[model samples]
Target: MYAFVSVSHPDEIKDRKRQGKLRQHAIRNGIQRSKADRAKKDGVFVPVEMEGKTTVATKRPTNTVALTKAPSVSLMDPFDTLCGCPERLRSLMRHPSAKQAGEPIFCVEDSGKPFFQGMETIFRGALTDPSLFHALSLVLSLAANNNLPNVEILQHRGEILNGIRVNIKGLKGAPQVSTLTAMLLLIGYEYRIDGADCNTISMHIQGVQTMMKLCKERNVALIDEVQRALFWQDLLSCLMAGTPRFLSHRDFSDFKNPIGIDQSQQWQVPKGLEESMMHWPPECAIVLEDLNALCWIVDSECNPDQEVLETFPIDNTQANLESRLMDLLRECRNNPAEPDPWYEACILAAYICTYKLSTGIWMGCYIPEICIGQIFQVIAKIPVDAQYKPAPALLQWVLFVCGGMTERKNIRQQVATLIRERYPDPTQDPEQEWETLRTTLKSFIWCERTMEKRIFIFWNEVYPELHTVDSSRNKMLVV
Candidate 1:
């Protein structure tokens, strides 16, 4: 079941063509320079003046292309051709169908709809750009062929990295939105494909954040629907890494709310405890948004001042959220009738995030083991179709959280089985694949051990597996 249910329509070709013409007109009138033109002028050519003579100087070329009347023939690496060089990738990306397709190649698991609105805009622009397309295509290929053998995976990984380096080295002066998108894709590749080190991913996140700020300063509106989705994903990554987020609430201010319960006054729950439990307040989305925003503030780059801390006391905030959650759960229990499992699952997911935020701020002082177990139980009761329908991205994160927190052997096995069933890898052994995923989750948690000295010390006692010198050590599986 996809977490989000909103379907996206393809952008009108004429509209994009009109925008392209207007942009060209602006460039002709000196309103802006084409990114390619700017790239060419920016340090690509150096003027040399000697004895009143001027000559254009060029650096050693990465590849050779004969200058002739006929189409220049460039000799390139075989791997480059096989992997889809930037130019070739760009052409493929700009195909009219690419815009119509809406979804990025790497996000195929999220078929039937674009992850969010404004993705068309980002994809449309990305397809026509060489560097961005190369990065985007690399990520897409990785996601599509995740089950490839280790040898093939390594080969592809190397080629993609080289392609990124060659293209990015050519980008000079100010960073463009396309460049930022490319960087975001690279980070996604590291997280999803490579199982990259936390420090490496953190550095890339920081780089993207810097690029975003640069775009804003230049009046470049880069944060569209696609970017908002990426930003949210990165925020989740930050939480796992125990690092502050680069993209904050202000960056995604224009983001649309995820689909949820009806907020209209005309919408009402039936008059029974079981019925009410099966329904969520329209305000549920608002509360989730608030929780996300509060999480951003709590994990902001700067430490919270004493005054700020006092105003939004972590303990009180968590208690209130938990209380509200319990009230809803209690209503269902009192009625002796089962609530809609799906609705109950959604509430449990929301609480998981709420608790996660609190744990991050307080260094896991309040373990939500009970809530975590409830999430698994409710999820187990939910139909497979329902689990994937509402919002896949959100659902994925919630499942990741559930996987991370649970120590119960049966629950861990269940989570692993569910993941394999949902996202099968035909090339890999299912058991081994799920075990690797579990290890990855534990590694992520282990990396965050230094968020607070006391917390680290406390976790060392509670989670003895953390005592190992190798920070990459995985926690012991709970029997």
Candidate 2:
């Protein structure tokens, strides 16, 4: 991935508040020197000396050092390369005219444009450029379809599970592409072109899903791509607010009347804690990094006393229960936070749970009491759909947990089960239920992990080395 490091001039340090006064003191001493020069004559300091000798007066050292304010030149080319940018773009980053000699460096370009304009421009360019767009799409598709292992699938097959590992080596040399939207388009193209191989298409889809998920997780914006167009800030808000449990007790009375605490108290919470609570229900508060922002939003939009406090206790309990249940849907599948709006919207759908049979805690721990009644009324209408159907993985997880294949309610359970048709005979030894289950799940996970690692290692590491060796002979012959 392309990244940047910020650079600043050393002279800017002197003007900092802690050092500004010292700098001024030094300047004043220079003024004193100038004053002493005026007292001398003919550009030389001469003094009448004893015994009829004349001598020049000692002069203080100059305080002035050469200072040049120039636009950063070293970084210009690399930045240009990253954007697929031409020379003209440099004008956009340069100062319009020279100014006072001592100001800290800044992009003198007009502030009328947004900070992300450069990113947007490059994205647009990538969309129009075929080669760049194709590479980006492939990268995104790969990111979307990543699936880690589950325990049950392995144990059923007499296998063990290992942890998942990312092939960073392959990622490093992958084709370069610009713009999130372009990447998605390219991924779609790959799927269309591959034809007939459902597995290959599925893999491409996963990649795209991963890319979009990462973008959402990172809070990056997809300004205007048709494939993914969510703004980063909006995605985060959705992630925080869409939980049924968090929304269960939410005040529907209008933005002015919030469900939790009075507006004033909301400001007291830390930001990182509030954000961390995004994955948690409303009752549990976490210490967060952006406490100040949390305070601002709560004070401005939320009013707890008018909402939750006024509700009946039984109603509040029901609402709390429903929220917990809904939150479970968000975890049912692995979705990366990426800039793709569709993937984000899909993840957001966890709040609108009607398709499957779920109870209060399984939904969301913090869903408002009122919404539960609302959702409870219309759950029959939601349709069940799983793109790239991860039934196999799901099956594995269920088997690992339950210890065998069984159905609980409408949900499928995949645990290893120990069954007794009748009372056990006195002569029979008791079955080792827990250890067998653990061993089985462990084996299942290990097998899946092994395959995934093999694919990644060979493609990312082994293949590259082999390719390098193969190319060496050809290069020598050409030379």
Candidate 3:
């Protein structure tokens, strides 16, 4: 069943938009150079002079401050004393749709793992643009109203806003504005704040408009390069299970074209799973096996239940596609560039495991458990002699599957065996190494892209309803 029964709608909270708008107004009025156009180079920050006050004279400006280098930064500055955004944010808190005393909310603790925490580093470092900041501010404000801001917020506000009037708090470097804005932009405006408003359709549209207004007022791009990056991040989070750390820095590349399948597909599957299969769970292996079986059944006389393909009953499927996807990987094992056409067909068949039986649900139960044993097994079983070259795509699939799964000892062994079996020497042709590297990279990218697709569908379509249903049932049980 879907999980979001008790989830509150943000819009359901009375005047949340009004509160948010007011705060946005306050931010517009209070913030200096909210626009990227006004941003000074990192080293060039002059004290924002007040009308009558002098720059707080501390020790002479250190000559050592690297003017050419970016300024030192924090992900979430707990030292900020500025409470400028809180009052307006608190106004949003009073919204009836905001979290009530017993309503269910996203598990902040579940999200607190260090792997997730690293996202802050990505925010502070690679993602220092205005769209990101606006997104961050919006999410944080929502977070503030839903639950108490982490104690860190209070501590930082105390420090940053020290001796300053409450009204002027948002002016000084408000990290929340930067951090949360990035997150919202990353997750995008489509996500509904649980418990806010249940009836309004197209939360993404509302979110985008709200975010765009903030961006326009601040003169940030509603959709820009950084926005694309943030979108990618959000997509990855939604589809792929576990923390962000498993997703590496090299995974994101400006040069790579994002897989441009339908937005619906984007919602359904994550990218880069061609390489991520290493992390799949044992259950995924079973699912992958089933998918291989399904392909066999489709080609043969077995009359499988048509409903097994339906997306909604995924968790209850007789031959869970997720398990089949894992088995497909195991069967695909690492062969070099040359294998028989039938073997190639076997590899292509593996992708079907990712497909829904009927409509459009991406059952990815195999990704987290995928390891090298299965991957190598597929390769070792498929024979390769001089007469036949494996489907070129097989290498890509191998790398992609490995990327999603975790690294087990078997994976390393398979890698070694595949390389030795395929290109036995360091002196192997330069062209071949290049091909290998390129294929590997492609697989990894595909894995990441697949992950992104899955996340969007889960959060936007699945989780909200599921959580609501779950919450409703729980409440009923309690009563």
Candidate 4:
């Protein structure tokens, strides 16, 4: 769960246009960084020259090594020791990645990469805790199947649900870390499978909330890991339900508003936001500043120490961002600014960030449909003509975010076409397009490390005929 922070040197910030590079995830060592640096300078992607597993090679993990928990693991090791990752998940998350074939575009399969924060600790408890093992096993099964509940998943889920019903009656509150982990696991599993609004999911969330309240009554403090995970889930659930977050008494007092370094100050506006922001509702702009600040925290402060985390929790920052946007939308619902694509695009980007970054469930979970629908609406309303046209740079960012949000091939192809409509130069190679667009997106709220591979994929998909000759070669060229 360590963040992939990609901070740029301060002295070079201006000359670099405050652009940050996500150190490549596939090659989690310094060698990849050097290659990526060279690629950036030359405006190209250079694949690692490896013998067995090429940097860009990706496939299903049918006959691969079993990803069981190791005795010890490196932070960059994509596999966790306690909770073994299934090969199927590892395949989908492979950096030279494509989702498992036939998988839906924006499904739970697209949750962040394999390794996550506090995962090791949680699984360590599973070693001796039957309940935690069952809960965690069910979650891994759900994720492995892309949240589709299979026979085994159903049986396991039933056991956990029924057991909780009976055991919860005699509880002395959120009694143990293992107990809390199992509960959180079940809450995450139900939400991804049945959605946040489902009565079952709500039941889990409320039960956790009640337990936390009871623990506070007895003055038993939760460690940071469990506290952070619970806080993140509750905030996301609140956003989905269109209700204010139920930050429990303990979490509420412990967590404060965002306190990270403010990189959005005098933020260099990208061409996209630059052209259209003047007309945006004032409130939206305020939220955007906060949005950039959150993006910076998530993107650059990857490995914050405990004290740093205590002061500037990423979860609180995201919760605040979502709340502000929802508030602004409420105020504007009466007489919405007549379909300003730029206006809606900014908001859409913010929602995507909040969901994609902070949804503590690393594998499977539902992103609320509220923002998903708005993505299409904004796309359809995009003005094609030059008169009163917003910058394509904005569209590029919006469409890329929207593409990441959807699993439908049609939607993705449509995104490439529209993006091409603005850039309309079949003569341009993806390397150049990515380089140009990459710089433009940095000015907006984006995480390059998380998105660079997707950007390359979209660019290639949109212009496969750009003299690359061989399609497979084109995709691999960027490896």
Candidate number of the best lDDT: 4
TM-score of each: 0.35, 0.19, 0.23, 0.55
The lDDT ranking, best first, is 4, 1, 3, 2
Cα lDDT, model 4, residue 80: 45
| 1 or 4, greater by TM-score | 4
Clashes within 3 Å, all models in order: 12, 87, 121, 7
Which parts of model 2 are misplaced by more than 4 Å? 1-118, 131-174, 179-181, 185-202, 205-328, 332-378, 381-479
Task: Using TM-score, rank the candidates from best to worst.
Answer: 4, 1, 3, 2
TM-score (C-alpha) between model 1 and the true structure: 0.35
Q: Local error of candidate 3 at 139, Å?
A: 15
Error of 3 at 343 (Å): 12
lDDT by residue for model 1 over 1-479, one digit each (tens)?
A: 11322325455434766567666666665634466577678547644444435444434435536575553344222224333464544343344333322122223222222222444456553444555655655544443453232554355456546655665577565566666666666665565533446777888777766665566666666455435645644644442333344554433323333122233423322121222232455545345444444444455532434333444455445444443444444444445564566556656655665555433222231133445656667667767665335434334445665555544446545655665566534344533543454444332112122122222222333334334533333333211
Write one digit per residue (lDDT tens) for candidate 2, span 1-479: 22232338677565566375666677888888888878665345444334435544355444434486555555434333432333333333332321110011111224312122224455443433433323332222222222111232122112100100122223433222233333333333232221224444344345545655555555554422322222211121223333112122232222212234334443433321223244443432311112223223333443434332233222222233223333433443234342222222222222222111112112211222223223223222223463333223223322222211112222111111111211122232212332332344333212221122222222112123333322322221100
lDDT of each: 0.46, 0.29, 0.35, 0.55
Clashes of 4: 7
